[model samples]
Target: MTSEEPGDSSVVRRDRFSGGPARGFLSSLAADERIFEADLAVDRAHVVMLAERGIVDGETAGAILAALDDVEAAGHGALPDGEDVHEAVESAVIARVGPDGGRMHTARSRNDEVAACIRYRLREDALSVVEATLALREALAETAAAHVETTMPGYTHLQPAQPTTVAHHLLSYEAAVARDTARLLDAYGRINRSPLGAAAFAGTPFDVDRERTAELLGFEGVLGNSMDASSARDFLAETLSALATHAVTLSGLAEDLVVFSNRGYVDLSDDYSSTSSIMPQKKNPDTLELVRACAGDAVGDLAALLTTLKGLPRAYNRDLQRAHRHAFDAADVVGEATAVAAGAVRTATWNEGALAAAAGEGFSTATGVADLLAMAGVPFRTAHEIVAAAAPDVEDGDDPATVAAKLDAAAEGVLGENLRTHVNRDDLEAALDPARSAESRDSAGGPASPAVAAQLDAAADRIDADAEALTAGRDALAAAADRLETEVDRRV
Candidate 1:
């Protein structure tokens, strides 16, 4: 305020407008920290491209690049106030290199520059989410491999449906998370494209090499349409949608663990648990409860973001500035939640005996019994009816002799034949054993130990492939950084 320059106008405007109170509301500088480094990199690439195209002299490009290095070292906090990071960065450069610094903005506009910066920063965030999800899948697969035979009750509608192993349950989640990871990676493909050189939606008059800038910045390619390049925020929306879906998966896992802990079928380690303020015996899974609630926040963010963009006209609006934070916030929320879920799953301990005991409760083995009768030449519906009749007399796995007697009597009414006419009594007794019932399920992806082993092998192969893909992505980003620095060194 003390300087000769008017606070209301920027370096580019040079005091054309008067100061007002609404400057605070209009300025996005205070909340632009996430894109600070990205803005620097994009600015650097654009400057180099301008020099190579003879839009600016080589010496001037070197000086501007040198000034940018100082600005970066001084850090974002030292930036002079402006409407956004792009202006703040330009102002800093002009201050360092004097009049020659103005050459850096020759063929660019804030529209294209901000779009490029958002993509540069968001690609990293998207990759981080992918890495966290892959780690969670690895944890699930590892835990499941160790418990291929650990029997548990699988439920539908919160009631015991059948006997299944812990491996089967955990691997089911692994499959769900794998699909989420795929969505994130697919979104990353779209997010990494360069939007630089578009120059205010219509593109630059100066013969700028869009592909050269993209190469320097690690973008897979340039966004072909200048209007779409600068105006499109669909990639942002897609990323948030992917994260919200993953958060739903995370909530389901949290719900299952919470219910399992409640039923004494699992115990979360102390690292992931909490005690009540007043109740002495309370060991609550508070971390998981919070994780379950994170899904709502993610969904809310997605809704707000989409609502903000519902009817805006194309090609870079100021509203875009307000929209990015929703995507950024959702990505952060889901990323942290994914890591917490992975840790909780890895550290948890399953109660085998309790799970097994609960597996056979409430005639959970009724399906297995019905299957046995159907295999014995009785119509499948007749078998189902006979098993339902026997269910009221005794639990399927509790009293084998009582269940057998009831089944034969029920058969007399339903089929007019004894149960032993088809299946031997030994086979009848074996079918009533929950553990034996699980063992006999040798179908692909069944609860049997052998089937679970096949699933483990498939899961390992997938985790390895995803880990390699993530590593390749990180390597590409690192290589781009190195290439940009080397080229900058040549210019400086």
Candidate 2:
């Protein structure tokens, strides 16, 4: 070991190489603000566990914990300059109680401690994302519930392809977001496991009770292997991946809203829109455009995290320090984007006339026409060909009279028979009408009023289930916090 730097009070016990350029290079105090409270909680749990295990006396453990309370009150900004939050906190504790404060680090390593702190903090972040996702789904369902039969254009490759109700359009996005919520909640299960007692990547001889600390910290359980507990950052990667995917979902939702806003089919609230600096007539979907662009940042953050973790050896490394900003940044941005999306959906207005008119343009009901022909004894492909050929001559695809006349003419040319030979004019007219066409395709999960109403009910059930789960997770953590405080009081 090298010489100890006794003059600098900020430096913890390990002082072989201090005050070098590498010291500043290796510091993580700035990036550690998010985990400060987490570190304090982990310290309290570990100190309580150490006293219980007879590794330290109740007097020292209580003193260290009390000093920790002082350190926490001082806040991360007031922390002494150290290599990281862990060292700075330990140093602060030592300042309060002298060498006895050093006992708080007993039977634990920065390796396991940092892991535990990250998991503790990240579990809350994951749950927050879940909450945001459910909120967005609720907004979608509310808007959809109100417009179950409001006919709108559905598109393929951004070109109008069919007439669907506004409810169907919004519910599709809700379904995607519900899945994103599940992914985040599932990841939370993995993140809430404790890594605390895995001292420096190996078990210590002090008989440390990992599960006791885990329980105090609200972890579902302790990691089974000390080495794995100390080294694993896979939880971080999985969480970033989930957040990035949800960002992509939000991007798609944002894209649709941006496009609809441009088409005059939708108009977002002024709170979610911005006016152009020079163009007096312009109301830009700036929030949505940023949300759409956030996908790239989310993807980049995930990529950076995964790349940093690549090809590392089994234990903790200095490189791991660089990985957390990615997850933290992604979590914060994705949650904000999700909430903004929820607000935008809840407050936006839809143009019923524009949506209805656009819903019928571009031969949108031709598929329903073909389906009608098929039902009336014509081969489906033959019906499709008839409609495809007739579309060019019809002056207005939405006009049933004109579409029927063109289809009859095209059928005579294609099969030497009028479409009237297969289906009656009344049936043809219903098939060509956009409103009737939307209602006609009333299979399960379809765009019809009854189908969308069924979907709304289902969406309500899912939101309830997810909200209950969210509340359970939060309640469990709050209870754990109470238990931890009780333990601290007994020792103090």
Candidate 3:
């Protein structure tokens, strides 16, 4: 029995972790690199607050800030090597400024650090998602304006239900995206609190200024409870849930685009659509399909975070670090997918004749027929069934008047002359025409030309308001990041 040499034992241990005797360390795949710039901005604010409050001497604080700046300047702050980002940062600071650089962790723990970084990232990414949503809203508004008078068939249960202007259909999506933007903005409000200075699962003994850190970090305030700050992932879940919802909404619109782009229906321009590689006759709506398919990844991202947090312990766990990859992936997926979807809407062409032909189908005017019978004192159900029976086997191109005339002659024998006083065949013919039916719906938000015009105008105003708000928010974030850099440079 002989003891192994120290070098030999080290070699064995390295192989155990590496699964090979002499392979180079596995290079990080960089699957889900976080928004490190935002995290560094937060770190800068935390250091500045420590100096201002005298928690660390001004020189040490200045050195740490300078090291951080240097790291950022060298290819945007390469993440330090450790179990996680907080450890990586602390290791870097210590390497740069001796033991005093380690003092920055005196009152903070990786638990609090992780929470703070996530919050900072959430706040930044939430605003970017909102901006992307505003772009989609703007494109929808533009589409609505271009097609305000282009009639199309609206459906219920995928069956033609009524005649609606194409603008009306487009504006429906704009309204949906506007609501999605508002939801992301609301989530940002909830994520705007600072989690720094919480220190693990409890308050620190040192007299640290959380409010000052919050101000420097551009957070509205310190999180109210230390324990909650360390353990809560609700903000991340909620923000990503909102993103997933937006993705789902866009996927639905994309599905509609895919269907509309097919030769079986509307003929979309070749610029916005692609042809199949192996089949010359096949024009594939690949862009819209991509938009539709990308939604599943966003949804999977939300589910992954939720599953990771489902049974976690009170304080932070190593598993929490693993959560970053999916959250980061989700934001990038959302941003890119949303931009693609918006571009498709802006550039795609619509065939107005196809839309008009779809609208003119007599089946789409059944509701108008029901309205007509109700106007003539027939009970609504009775009117519906009556029209349903007489509804010109439109498959055969039978006119509504011709169908109504046969029904009128039959009723002449069944209900005597009383039916003649209530029903006019000519009136029925006018009621069953889709163009007149669309024009008759002059109510607000209806498919009537004027109604759709007003909706387009309102959507434009909302798009501008949303875009301006997003711009103001982004400018503020940029300024905060700039201020941190400026302050760090000043001290250095």
Candidate 4:
């Protein structure tokens, strides 16, 4: 080992130095400024709580608050020359108050402080994720509304099965996104509880006002126990899980868009597609593919986080720090990817002719035939058997009108009721194609023009409500931040 220099802390070990090609540290680059901001919030509350509890002098608490306000004004708190976030903060306080800033840290440990910081950051980021989710929902809703009556082939087993409205298909994703939004909200609720009082794996001897700190910082409540607070990374893990789930959901939608954009099914907007560099004629749905790829990244992050935390026997460990990058990176990936998907949906185009043609080629109205037979008073199962036996003989590629005619004449003596009245034989043969059939279904959630219109109206209302809620939540957080800053200033 090299001799220790006058100011050197330790000799650099050659074994560790040459262990492998050293990667430059970007760990600190992932430092969530929101987390640092949260730390400031916690500090403001902590000083006030200390003063109220008589653990620290009024002047010391007051000075600490003022120093914090100054730190905020400067856009950073007391970070140290060679330390991490916690030490940096305390160092700033001492610089401002001539050693009194050091007292504010008395009852707390870095463990609890770090936990609170993460919670605050998670709360802030979760809201954005929710907003992105809502935006995606609205985009799908808009697409659904515009294409409600536009007919498309509904597939089962990758084969055209029936005619369904494009609006109906789009609404299916809206329903999915709504659930994702709810999941995020649930995750936010869990994230709201504060861990500030946990104090490094055990309760502190000091009579700390953890509840007061929690309230001052706008946390829902103090964590029930100290050890659990310091040791629990569940909040971080849970937030990532929510993000992963949303990513998976978005990926599913992206897959559909990719398939739809291929080979004349749906014409994706030029902005969302790209020409292959080598292929002379290729409009690749590269953007959609990216969204799908991002979902895989989100999933990997989720698994990586869980793996990082799984075997650690911990109140706190350096290894736990590794979890931060995945969480932060996944959040960014999800936010940006969701935004891209929303924009694509807003600008995408569909091929009405292609969709209608595809819908008609595979006896798309077979189910409707069964539906009509049931309506004519034959029990559905019997009607199904009768239709099933007659179906193969119904002529391949026959349109709904021809099928209706064959059914009507075949069942003339058996099932009673002018089937022709309910189904147009002549017009159904010529103009009443699958595209029109999709327009005719008007039941709730159906692809009928009127039903699709109703769905669009409902989706609009839901989108407005979700957007308002998100705005209000953000405003509340901002207000809390402002109030905390102001209160600290008053004390200083």
**Superposed Cα RMSD, model 3:** 5.0
Better of 2 and 4 by lDDT: 2
Please say which candidate is ahead in TM-score: 3 or 4. Answer: 3
Model 2 gets an lDDT of: 0.89
Per-residue lDDT tens digits for candidate 4, residues 184-220, read: 7777777878888778888799998888887777777
Candidate 1 lDDT over 235-274, as tens digits, reads 9999999999999999999999999999999999999999
Per-candidate TM vs. native? 0.97, 0.97, 0.89, 0.84
Tens-digit per-residue lDDT, 1-492, candidate 3: 113222222221332553353322331213213645665676788788778878888888888888777656763236443334454555556666766666767678767876888888878788888888888888888887888778888887777789887788889999898888988888888888888888888889988898877777777788889988887888888888888999999899988888777534455456667887798998787877888987899899999999999999887776776676676677788888888888888887778887877875647787786787688887888766665655555442556666566556544554454345786767777776777788889889898888887888788888788778778877776777777777778788
The order of the candidates by lDDT, greatest first, is 2, 1, 4, 3
Better of 2 and 4 by TM-score: 2
lDDT of 2 by residue, 372-441 (tens): 9899888999999999999887654336777788898999988899888999999888877788899988
Order of quality (TM-score): 2, 1, 3, 4
Local distance difference test, per candidate? 0.89, 0.89, 0.74, 0.75
